[model samples]
Target: MKDNFSGHSDSYSKFRPGYRSELISYLVSLTKRQQCAWDCGTGNGQLAVKLAAYFDEVYATDLSENQLRNATPKNNIQYRTEQAEKTSFDASQFDLITVAQAIHWFDFDAFYAEVRRTLREDGVLAIVGYALLQVDESTDKVIQKLYSDIVGPYWDPERKYIEDLYKTIPFPFHEEKTPVFHDEYQWTLEQLMGYLETWSAVKHYMRDRGENPITLISETLKQSWEGFDTKTVTFPIMLRVGRL
Candidate 1:
């Protein structure tokens, strides 16, 4: 897996949106047991903290120690710095395995091998993520230009999986149908900028140019965002659940 967010782990933990309760409840309902869960590539423990409430134990692992350091603490949750493709977990340990917004970075074959080895017979593997955020048409137009024109070439190849909505990703399991879900937030323009700053492509652009690209679109975004102290931002959730 790639370690893209470690440098701005603090910003990640603060600005990234959490999974909605409806989505969490739905995942919990699919499990036959709530004994334990493994959240792989669990950046900042966002999904791990949620699983903690439903399971006896939740083990969240990430390749970035900086991200793990800022993870939210829960009594039943254990955060570790580990790769997604391999782990020290025992066989048939987890009742459910979850990868939230991080599976695109994994070596799928290797990760699936570990999933098959560690997941119980009835365990479900849930891969979840969200599409690009949507706001008003005017703001969205400016944002789209920034995404496609400004930093388009900077995005990693793995981003194609997300753009395809995970439909084309390798999944060798019995797939389950899932309901449509979304994450909605009331955020200010500054909050939106903070979230955009967390994008890996933006980080890559800054690295190569020695300048933050967000500055280029700031004034336009401010003008587009005028008249609203807080705007409704919606992220359409994409989920793929399966069993080995």
Candidate 2:
């Protein structure tokens, strides 16, 4: 289960993404029994640990033990190394289920069936996903080139959403986008490099070609920024949900 992320633990933990409180509040409001929630694909348990503060219990599961190691040692968070397609929890066990940046890696049909079997009738299933990044027009031009020209071809087609495709799946579902606000995080050159190194597309590209992505990324970042400080990089995230 933990095979894919076997050796990238440090890159993942230090440079992984996180969610906003606004998204969390919205998810809680949708659930009647916010007392118990299950955080599916709980990478590093960032969102789940925060959720534990809002709920009496949280069952945050992931296939990667590398991720679970950073789950903050929370007593309220029942961390488990369970695949989304094959979790051990009983039917209607959770009042809410949150899937953050990791849903793109799921087996949708199997995952949906499990969600159907596990969530309470009124439970909310908030699925969140982030994109390459957002920045000012000048900065965005460079990022856009990187996304479309350099990085786009290598993305896992199995992972990316084929617009409106999930709607065709046989699950009772509803879709909603979070507030259209950008999240800005400041990054030093090294910190920014670390973030890019964590991207699976970049990792796979280098692996498939037997080239070092970090070296290229470092060279590119240096060339692009004249005198870079901790400038902001905004990322947009969207969430869709429904009761099963």
- Among these predictions, the greatest TM-score belongs to 1
lDDT of 2 by residue, 182-201 (tens): 45788666776777777666
Candidate 1 residue-wise lDDT at 123: 96
In candidate 1 the C-alpha lDDT for residue 194 amounts to 97
lDDT values for all models? 0.95, 0.73
Residue ranges of candidate 2 with Cα displaced over 4 Å? 1-3, 162-171, 174-178
User: Candidate 1 — worst ten consecutive residues by lDDT sum?
Assistant: 77-86
Off by over 4 Å in 1: none
CA lDDT, candidate 1, residue 140: 98
